[model samples]
Target: MSKNLADLNSLEERISALEKIAENFKKRAAEIDEKGEFVYENIADLKNCGYTVLTIPKVFGGKETSLYDYIRLQEVIAQGDGATALSIGWHMGVVRNMYENKWNPKVLAAVYEDLHAGALINAAATEPQTGSPTRGGKPQTKAEKIGDKWVINGHKSFTTMSVVLDYFVVSASIKDSEEIGNFLIRKEKKGIRIEETWDSIALKGTGSHDVYFENVEVEQEDYVETLGGAKRVNPWLLHIPACYLGIAGAAQKEAVLFAKNYAPNSITGTISELPSVRTKIGELELKMLQAKYFLYSVSKKWDETKEEERELLLPQLSAAKLVVTNTAIEVVDLAMRIVGARSLSAKSPLQRYYRDVRAGLHNPPMDDMTIGQLANFSLNKY
Candidate 1:
């Protein structure tokens, strides 16, 4: 077997190794959240593990793990720290998308090389004027063709991983054209800087700040894709819902531990022995199981699906994301109830989980949009 394929055969072993490394992230998660600082050390640890380039194809000297493998690893990382997991998810998803789509050959080669060297990338599409790109909002940022360069000027909001990104795949309206192109901008380039503007109550350590660009120049080859391209069902995006489910897993663990050990004077045994507590725990487990099965089953289907048949599964994919993310929020809430008032303490990780899971509701494939799409899909199918 090829070395890369052979390595993938040992995914469980590799995941075990990653789990050990995640311990340090779990240990430092509270501190990172409390300080509201970027998880630089976590990123460094992931890079050292060759995770930063996991999405680059094997030909480019990367692991080129499948979407399932990537989702599994992301869930493991999220179990330790949701902010770190979410921050890195952008990089992993972007790289995987580039590899799968094979954009401009020259640009892809450069990005692959950078990925090998531990570079991170995220699509800078959301702007102050337009909320989510999925909502079909045109970018306010504009890219103009100069003598031999494309000069870009615009601002992007919620630029996740801004503190650690080496490149940004930004969306900009083409000057004098109706087209909106995704431009690749380097971090060290002049006139591109991250503004300290993110002050969200959740995902506090994601470094998702406002990014500004004024006359940032790049070659024409840097523009990856024009907006309004044919849409495809993106299975890799399942990593997002997976991350929140991981956070819920952490909260569940904490709650179970508390229920097993905290025996009050009024009870004959620990709270876990109480019928009411057991019912809540059962409900939590059932919901989690359903969401996970939906996620992984759909992910596996995507892996085996023919390219032409993939678009037919868009409703299922969106439904999985919506179900898993919404279930994650409720799972965290139930976990907190299991832990009672102690879950509210700053020292408890449940509070962090509660806040972090809510961010998933705002992620792409938004709940309302997904519901509307599902309704349309059902009517059309009938």
Candidate 2:
């Protein structure tokens, strides 16, 4: 008999209990799809495990879980299947943005209720010209007011989990006003097209395809919020870190495994026995520890602090994403070094992990931009 999670006597206890299964999911994540597919067959079970609802606030049918718990949970999910974790992370993280929005009470309730019911979501704000929405650009997607409705026209690229997302938080420019707004777009809507154009070397299975909207009409009331010329707390963007955290956590775990099993015939022992290998592992371990702690800490802060307090931490959040993703790439490379040519095989996960971890640095506030921001902030101080 399936148990209603709402009926659990102690939700924390149940989540802790569920985390154990999440660990199992992580280990079996890659093993489940040796071919590195991304349709995410396990997404349903992820909800059953209480992951999809974990980020939601209790007031809106969400657990409104602690930030630390959210980060840890993301790590668990990512460890299983990097692509799957990366795919769902954007949607799960966006729930926080959704709660913070001025969406209609009924729409908000409906969204969360389904999240509680084990559904996933995806935010579609990226475009072909602008790239990941985090870079901050005027969208090519235009939404024109047409009588009682809005006609949305444009293509969105890198729409992760577009197939399974209950709805997309699509971004577009308001005609006449030159204002930017985000609206809730449903898959069933007419004139909305799903294009299978996700051709990437990494995260191949994420199905982050190009989406075409041709006069797709939407009600005015469904508009989530107006982005309105660059304000603080960009609601349409709140993932990246969660995705990289999972990959970093996975890399760390892989590093541990390699360190334990890598016996080299040259030393008549495991390469892990060598000081050089251990030194590399040590470098990776330290970086992983730092990134993991930063990711979890920031997530918790996001959950607890008032809106004002969050602004001061944006730079820190950017740093966390940059560091975590970079560390994941570094850590995975170190692990591959321990395994040598063996890790280069198509059969080896090291190759896939390598490509996947680098994706973090490529997405959202690009590493160069983050570095530039850090530099600018430092230069302006004092």
Candidate 3:
């Protein structure tokens, strides 16, 4: 683990640099998708640019990026490469959790160092039997306290960036106790292996695979967070929608470019001359504007609001995720229609965008669940 010169410049400069770097990934992104390989180069680029530790608090030798700033940068990255943006978003979000003092002092110190060194950590809470831990299913993974170390064993699904993660925050039930905790395990330890199980057509380069832990030993203090009761919607997690929104933006750009220049032998002019094509573009723009307002305003609200007030904003956050993700999907569909059959060709990105945007529908704070929660709130108020 080493440190880079803290490029303590203006936030705008930092964001602009990252956006430029992301733009460079477009070709690489297509290659990664075609090969169905991990976006290893993309992660390495982010690390080299010192973007990996941007969220660590200033006091802990990081840029201390604001939640809004984080989302804004992620959108830029996603616009260029959705899989890379998504893979790193999990790392950025989980590391930001440390700012809330969620981990013990010793653990926090070690984590800060690891993160600054460009290490990635993700919460491996999704299990085969329990699905997403957010659904309140008990984890089949168990940890036993033997002497001074905690021995952990279990399987995790959808471990995004498993190939590059240096550490994992794994949730496990204590051997004898009813309590569950998040154990921090280093990747170098024995008994930890990546299962290479992810074969999804969407986000093919994310490298989200199954990980198995067999008798992995961790220090007592490594159990950082208890798998406690339900928690409030984290405003930082808005990065999820930010990623999808970027994908939508990319699709819109592709469609607009094609419309502006595509002249056919049978047509009198380019597609941009067609009223229907213009209308679809207009719709995409309107939806994007609405989604951006919803996302940024709520994110700003989260930053300004007190922690207690933040808990009550679950509906707004959930709505932002639902609206943005749905809007992204629609935008991609429109892009595909505008581009016609060519959009579906493997050479075109619109098809990939269509597939990737749909994954957002399955992300946490699911559409149906959000609607139900909103209805529950409205009914109680009414």
What are the models' TM-scores?
Answer: 0.96, 0.88, 0.96
TM-score of 1: 0.96
Per-residue lDDT of candidate 3, residues 115-214 (tens digit): 8877888889899898877678989999999999999999999999999899898999999899988888999999998999999989999999999999
| Ordered list by TM-score, greatest first | 1, 3, 2
Q: What are the per-residue Cα lDDT tens digits for candidate 1 across 75-167?
A: 889999999999898888888887676688778888888888778889899998999999999999999999999999999999998988889
Candidate 1 CA-lDDT value: 0.87
Q: What order do you get sorting by lDDT, best first?
A: 3, 1, 2
Clashing pairs in 3: none
What Cα-based lDDT does every candidate model obtain? 0.87, 0.72, 0.87
By the lDDT metric, which is better: model 1 or model 2? 1
**TM-score of predicted model 3?**
0.96
Position 105, candidate 2: lDDT = 80
CA deviation > 4 Å runs, candidate 3: 1-8
Clashing residue pairs, candidate 2?
Answer: 26-80, 29-80, 56-64, 263-270, 264-271
RMSD of each: 2.2, 3.0, 2.3
Candidate 2 regions exceeding 4 Å error are: 1-36, 234-239
lDDT over C-alpha atoms for residue 291 of model 1: 83
